[model samples]
Target: MRAGSFGQLTQDKENTTQVTFHYVEGNTETFTIPIPASEFQEEVLQLLNQPWLTFHLVDQTVFICTARLIKVEIKPAIPELQGQGIFSNSMRVSTMQRAAAGRLPMNT
Candidate 1:
């Protein structure tokens, strides 16, 4: 999640694609599909070409009629840094070493 202005809610940039659809019936719905950052755009484009759009949520599958769609807003956000990289692991180890030696690691 990224910080914003005082009252703004932070959004998680986890590996997901946000697709907002505005139908002709004046209904708007947004969905977050679990997709990797590298393939977000291509996947979304493929999904949109079909007559029925399907999303697999946590407990259910949502189907949207693409025929009634009037507008769509697709945003492929920057995903958060996964802590599996070399720099992240090294930093974590360094911090743990400092704490073990009775020295407090400064927060970034």
Candidate 2:
């Protein structure tokens, strides 16, 4: 697995977010981005409007073609926080809760 500076998916990593890119050719690549929940959402929206996205790694930079990208998955890097946002702090809120608040669909 390719672990980035944002850290890996562990129970203790609540500050990190896991972003997975799915391509049209049935290939997928996952990256960990260390950003807050709101910031991460903004970044994703910006990426969707761009033609290409870049990932700066330790020794190299990876370029992604947005045209061939089929899907993008965003979730907390921590397994225990699966139902919560990136930085939920103390008040834990699940996707269902957010959906009820009209933030997202109730059945996504």
Candidate 3:
């Protein structure tokens, strides 16, 4: 079977979350499949049986590998820590102070 990508989302009802899967590509296509929370593992197994590139949820978006049998990196949707509003100024100040302190040896 040819490897392809799929997307999944989780929803909650009665304090339990359900997972849903959607086929991203194929000839016999299914737009989506809603799976109960209790059946999550089984659903994942079923998808993997097709050897599909599963897109996992990270923060707000889903990320799927570009190819099967290949380790593809998925960059996070969020900005880098240094670029984040909470850390940017502090990071810059710390970096400048460290530079002024001079470059120390690799090990302590």
lDDT winner: 2
**How would you order the candidates by lDDT, starting with the best?**
2, 1, 3
List model 2 lDDT by residue over 2-103, tens digit each. Answer: 766445545335666778999999999998767755567655666778998888888889998999988887775222333334455446689898777986
| Full-model lDDT for every candidate | 0.68, 0.72, 0.35
Better of 2 and 3 by TM-score: 2
Could you give the candidate ranking by TM-score, starting with the highest?
2, 1, 3
Provide the lDDT at 90 for model 2: 49
TM-score of each: 0.53, 0.56, 0.21
Q: Which tens-of-lDDT digit does each residue in 1-108 have in candidate 1? A: 455543342234445667899999999999876664567754555666889987877899998988899988756643433434313322235766867777656578
For residues 27-103, write the lDDT of model 3, one tens digit per residue.
12112223333444334434445544444344434433333322211111112323223333232358778886787
Winner by TM-score between candidate 3 and candidate 1: 1
Candidate 3 contains a number of clashing pairs equal to 0
Q: Which stretches of candidate 2 lie over 4 Å from their true place?
A: 1-12, 77-108
How displaced is residue 79 in candidate 1, in Å? 15
lDDT of 2 at 56: 88
If both were scored by lDDT, which would come out higher, candidate 1 or candidate 3?
1
Report each candidate's C-alpha RMSD, comma-separated, in the order given: 16.9, 11.2, 16.5
